[model samples]
Target: MAEPQIKDQRGWAPVDTGYLDNPKMLDVLDASGTAALMHLASVLYCAQHLTDGHIAPGIARRKVGGTKDDDRLLIDAGMWHEPGHDCPTCEQPEPNKVYVHDFLQHNRTAAKAKRASERASKAAKERWERQRAEQDTPTDATRMPDALHPAMLGDDSSNAEREKERKREGGGSRRTPSRPLPESWTPSPSHIEKCSKERIDLDHEAEKFRNNALAKDMRYANWDRAFTNWLSRDWVKRTSAGLDPMKDW
Candidate 1:
């Protein structure tokens, strides 16, 4: 039996309905599910075929912020190729595949290492600068002023002036104001030596006290007792204030 055939306006027979008869130009499409290989070939062919036409390959969006040639290099290295696809940059008519990791992995790794090194370098520089500044500064004792010591400068004039003022204020003017005898006054070297000896004795006592475990233990025990007492008193005050009763919980 002869099968009936259908024809189009151009006088070409209609495409076969069977799956085997209907052959697509490309065996595998892109991940976009579009038959990109055939389209790509067609685009390239049309570009080559026409002497003057808009056969330019579709341009990719340019990376704006500090665009690295590395990502573009990876693209050229065939990292993002579909099945039977060519490199867009090189126009290499070879099958190449593009992996997402290949482009990002190296860049991220380099960036992390660079960041760590920079942070470490910055920290070290800051520490060095601080130590240098400290070393350049004067010691605390040398920086302190001698004017702070009242004994170094003679300040007896102020007392003498006050005494004069007191004598003038009194209604009865005494012919002669009685004063203490200078013969009774004497600088005692023994007294000064004794005071120095006592100071040295106190320092030694402090050193001995620090060395003694019983003294340290007693100090800690006193502190703990005081803290516990304070805590108990505070708890009583807070309880009396109705803090616990007023709490939401």
Candidate 2:
């Protein structure tokens, strides 16, 4: 059977369901008697350290507090195999070491775990780079239009002509500059018709509008629009209330 591939081994260790019911495990449990826990502790220690089921003598004695008698019991029960034994599953056996039977078959080796970690890191880095590149690349909607590009303007004359065309089309970002109220400013015919329908005194409102603009030193890009807005909003209400429109200003 092919071994399962492990991409990351940080969290868990594999244990078979029939582990306690196995004949080899039964023999170790029965032979070790009161010392069975120590022998089992050695197995857990190897698993936690990702030793591929191999237990060093020093680790068994000092780390797991297991004596040579415990190792002998596991080895004799066929639960563990001594070094130099002809085991087909052992990858690189060291001298005087004992390996757990079928450890590699059930769990990840240290080498495999290291490789999985490196692969995960490399994949994460590649994903980050791809996302950053996508963000840095400009899409069509965000790119500047070729017609408005400064490099496409060619010269001063062409630029001025483009500006005039844009203003005529009323489709550019720039707005008309404002100036102080004109000395000859007057309400247009449309303004007169609107005021007449609304029963507003057009000439009186017009004179008041001019006086207020001059008194406040106001400026506007479109004086006609400003006067129309002022008439629509306040002139009718003030005249109905019998309040002088020029009193507030």
Candidate 3:
């Protein structure tokens, strides 16, 4: 023989056989009436119809595999309540409304759906905030590199960085000795002769002066002018002024 047919339903529903312990219910209702009440309870989970714990009489009877007679039995016993309110989610007016009494109290499925919707909404908001934050935030690439910033435009350290970049690109430790002196300072071989007398290698000294000035980030419109002035002072101090003949002429 075929196994006893199971009741048709959707998703999940809760049933508490514990109510069977009620003395009046156990003694008064037959099995068919009890079964009808349970069927309608599950049907109330359908938000499209039995929303908010109410069900249309025809749907309840049809799905319950009972009749209007079965429903009347439940109503007389105060087991069912009619549509008096709308579901927040479904929004059915009274004409289209059917509600289950205490739908929230016993329907775990509806409660679960509500919680899930709330969680989904919250997650979407957080994701949007994170994305917006990432967009508004800036990156290191947006800043000008220290090497490219003009010496006078930013800070004292910028000039030093600029000089280091020049050295890296042009090579360090040795600089060209033939660089021309600044026109305004007046150039002559006399500075070289004076340095030679002092036992200094003029070319090497000149190279060192240029490199040291650059490393210290000495700023001038013409570095050549500054360097020539420096050499002129040292040359004048070191060279003799005609052997200091004194008392005579």
Candidate 4:
């Protein structure tokens, strides 16, 4: 397949553009990057699947592998071909430059970006759930594992085993476990204290609402009688009067 010219296309700038400092710009740029990668992926899919045409000169024809390989290429374009050859079309002459840009690179970067996103999201969710659970279940009186605790060392064996299993299954052959966050980069004790104070303030607000007149009236009111009367009389009358019984609350 003819390599698409990397002309002055809009939004093809490198990832570290200054505009990305803004969250909106970051998202827009990332989305554009993803789109470009996807377009590259489609081109690669064609290269590997459709019969190889001349790349303006010398080169072996490309062929797509099995469905699994295809899927891998689709998910992670970086995994597609072993590092070899010059760009097929431009014939850039350098071995690294001779390579085809397709689904593999695009998909690999996309997968990395997506995985990072999911990991951050999972961490945030876990933190939120922990906070909520702690409302009913207090933290252990004993000190929990600090970042440097001995239990952290024990976790290494489990992580190693998982890595081995991943390689065995060929799922994570290229994946490396992420490094721990630096203490300076992570939330500090003072941050934790501030968050705790904020949580206490929120809980106090909820308690105040619970003690408010409206809340007291609603909680102490004849809920059962109201529900029973609605169910036995109002609901029955509504149903008999040709209202949809299923919808009548």
Candidate 5:
């Protein structure tokens, strides 16, 4: 089973206490071996995924800031091992560039620890992105595009309903203007004939009335209404009462 990693948010590292109890630790009393062991142990602890140190000989030696004599002492004390290579002079193992051994026993990063740390970093990054997206979004009341009507997201039926309502209010699309007729107007001979044949006015008087109504200068939706109104008001007043349609032919 994989060991669980510690939940340390402030970034702490792990150190096993078994090294203090090892009998070999007491045997390595020399200055070179002791320093080399400490340096190798620190490198292994910080290497992240490689719980076992697989550092290069030159890099490890340089990072440890130790001498050739110190590196050699580490091998003699069994504190470090070289994989896939041999020492030339002594025919013993020598440190290779690719892999170093015993880092697992001396490091902070186990498989479980690395997994936990990665998970934490990923979760933090996701949260930050979510917040940034939300902050960048606009929340104004009237910033919508012209084409985006309420019917699009709501219901398709509403579009038909709104069109019907518009027609009802406006009496449908107007083929002709509905502007009101003027109170006083002049009537053409054709207009006079259309309204009533009984009432009689001289051609000159009719023309005078037309010119006067034109002077009034009001617009009318139905010219028929204007002509009819003029006949009722002015034509009646001008015509002789004996020529009334009710009593006289």
Candidate 6:
């Protein structure tokens, strides 16, 4: 019947609303001729420690700061049971312990509290395991495609051959293919307006551009851009002196 020791003193213990109005409390109060604070303190100490109502003699004296006379008073008031008393709730009685009378009637036993703590710990562990499993599982979106799986697995020779084939077919190069200027090509309307604004003869410039490209066998990806470049760098305005504009270039 020795009081159990507890490390976790976290939760509240129940106290009846009419505790002070009880006959036993009234008797203890009358007998003590004082507040009877020690009796209430002992009851709380047993509850908080999950001691099953058992109070050690050393705890009553040293921890609770109760005198022998206080213990005697509570015992006389039927609020405490002395050591060596037969307890129906306990399988065997300890010789060096005192118990708060009817303590289990109002509070949880040590075994029950321990079981609840264990169950809570088990549930928390299971929840954490489930969360870990969910995080480790891969989704379909993140899974590698079957077509690219071999490439990812370091099939370097096949990958290199495919890259070379792509280059050979002009599929891998970023540049546009070059071609000779077309015989029927004409200046776009915007370029025609630009030449008119600058007083450059569009027909004359067009004839010279086509002749120059054909003469040199020059090739370009964008013929319009090539024409624009030719206009900017080579075209000359007709002079009033009657000299050929091409001769001024």
In order, how many clashes per candidate? 4, 0, 5, 13, 1, 0
User: Distance (Å) between predicted and true CA of 75, model 3?
Assistant: 0.6
What's the lDDT for all of these models? 0.33, 0.66, 0.49, 0.36, 0.49, 0.67
Global CA lDDT computed for model 4: 0.36
In order, what is each prediction's RMSD in angstroms?
A: 27.0, 19.0, 19.8, 30.4, 23.0, 23.5
Checking candidate 5 for backbone clashes, the offending pairs are: 52-104
- The TM-score between candidate 4 and the true structure equals 0.18
User: Model 2, range 1-249, lDDT digits (tens) per residue?
Assistant: 222343345635666687677787777767665335555555666666666776665565664566778777776776678876776866544575678777778777778777877898899999999999999998766654432322233456444544553454345643876577899889999898988787778887788778766655565667787677667755345673576444431
TM-score of each: 0.21, 0.43, 0.33, 0.18, 0.37, 0.49
Ranking by TM-score: 6, 2, 5, 3, 1, 4
Residue 64 accuracy (lDDT) in model 5: 53
Among these predictions, the greatest TM-score belongs to 6
Worst 10 residues of 1 by lDDT: 51-60
Cα deviation at 71, candidate 5, in Å, is: 2.0
> How much is the lDDT of residue 151 in candidate 5?
20
- Candidate number that wins on lDDT, 2 or 6: 6
- Total backbone collisions, model 2: 0
lDDT of 3 by residue, 198-242 (tens): 655566556655555555545444454444555554332332333
- TM-score for predicted model 6 compared with the true structure: 0.49
Clash pairs for candidate 1: 79-98, 79-99, 80-98, 81-98
Report the C-alpha lDDT of model 6 over 52-167, residue by residue, as the tens digit: 77776556666556678877887777677786566575422245667787888877888888788789889999999999999988776555432232213344543453354335
Candidate rank order under lDDT: 6, 2, 3, 5, 4, 1
| 217 Cα displacement, candidate 1 (Å) | 52
